[model samples]
Target: MSILVIGATGTIGSLITQRLADAGAEVKALVRQAGKREFPAIVTEVVADLTDVPSMRVALSSVRTLFLLNAVTPDEVTQALITLNLAREAGIERIVYLSVIHADRFTNVPHFTGKHTVERMIQSLEMPATILRPAYFMQNDRMVQQTIQDYSMYPMPIGSAGVSMIDARDIADVAVAELLRRDKASSALEPLTLELVGPQPLTGASAANIWSAALGREITYGGDDVAAFEGQLASYGPTWLAYDMRLMMTGIQRFGMQSTEGTVEKLQTLIGHPLRTYEDFVREAVAEG
Candidate 1:
């Protein structure tokens, strides 16, 4: 069966696309424009922009599954809904959505609640789906590469609270398993929700220490100041994006990022391996430098 991947050029989406193709699955990537950028020769690349819903139908042709990943944009909700109706109409049998951890609890966070709304809509439509709720990405630190490299410190107001962040690569692997697994329930059943998170809870201080050990330098933790954090965030993204992120961080500070044993069991069920740790990610990242 063929599978379609939206947001194919993005961080987690790109990893998911490559993993499926490498496994010899018949994959179709729904990108904005195929000719503008080169993709792997294994998968078929289709020109379909989420901004233009009309072009999406062509991408769904002959597809049985969809890996739906939308970013934190003003149009996120609108885009997902549009894609949902089209995918259902096209007779796509299954969908795997990339969502944030604790989406149901965080009603005010735009990206979280927005995805929660989509999750409900999908269930209401009786569409077959698996929701993967990934925790804070360990790679989020990449945004402050300059601070880490030049100042020898990590700058993000993660507070002293421990968070269960996940490696995007692991999320990609589990996404492929969900897509290709055919023994799942009927398309109309309640979707399966799984948590994709790190092996342990890590505070900002602990994470800084990990990076310091990996790089042989002391990396200080940036304190918990939402306004200042948002200010730095706005430098790289729009003001609203920064605000949204600060909200998420604040949620983490309040609720702590602990995961259940069930989450680990789910990961083992999908990949039959222990989840990757932050130290492992940091070592590889430093090695690549």
Candidate 2:
């Protein structure tokens, strides 16, 4: 069976593609730009844009499993609707979707709402689907690499609240396993929601300490000013996008984004190993740079 991975060049998508390829599955990497082909030699690269339904259909024609991942955009809902329709029409048996944590509760945030909409659409389809809701990524720390290198600080609005931040690589691993095992005989496998998380929940101060130890430098927690953080993000990102991220952070601090019990155990059973901790992610990320 062939597996098609959308956004294959992205952070989490790339890891999923690699894992599937390593497992001896016939993997196809979908990319909008021809020049962005970066997967290993075993992966077949297909060029298709998410907005073009016909092209996507052509890409999905011979695929049995699909990994759906998309960045937030104004046309997210339309794109997801068309893509899911095309996949079902093309006879795809299973889909593994990467979604944000607390998507259903955070309706005011456009991006999270978009993800929730897609999740509902996936449920409506007849194909077997696994919806993975992951909390804030520990990989987000990479965005502050420059700050960590220069000022030795990481800024976030999470305050002292502990978040069950996950590593993107771990998320990819679980997605790959689900796609590969879609046809396996299991009574408990259909229409499942997996709450993916890291080995432990950590506060901003704890995260800073982990990074500081990993990087062998002093790292400090900058601030808990959600409005100021939103203002700074707005200068670089779209207005709605900035607002959504700020609102999500505020919700995290207030409601606590830590996953419920058994998250790690369930994920480990799927991936066949233990999830990576914040400290482990820090060391690997630093080594890669």
List lDDT for all candidates, in order. 0.82, 0.83
Query: CA shift at 264, candidate 2, in angstroms?
Result: 0.9
Which candidate number has the best TM-score?
1
TM-score of each: 0.94, 0.93
lDDT of 1 at 279: 92
Instruction: Provide the lDDT at 188 for model 2.
Output: 28
Model 2, residue 91: distance off in Å is 2.0
- lDDT (Cα, tens digit) per residue for candidate 2, span 165-283: 89898888888888888734343257878888888888878888887998898899877889988998899889888888898888787766778888789889888888888888888
After superposition, the stretches of candidate 1 with alpha carbons farther than 4 Å from their true spots are 183-190
**lDDT digits (tens) for residues 146-241 of candidate 1:** 678788877767766678888888888899888878324344344788888888888878888998999898898877788888888788789989
Among the numbered candidates, top lDDT falls to 2
Candidate 2 Cα lDDT to native: 0.83
Residue 235 of model 1: what lDDT? 87
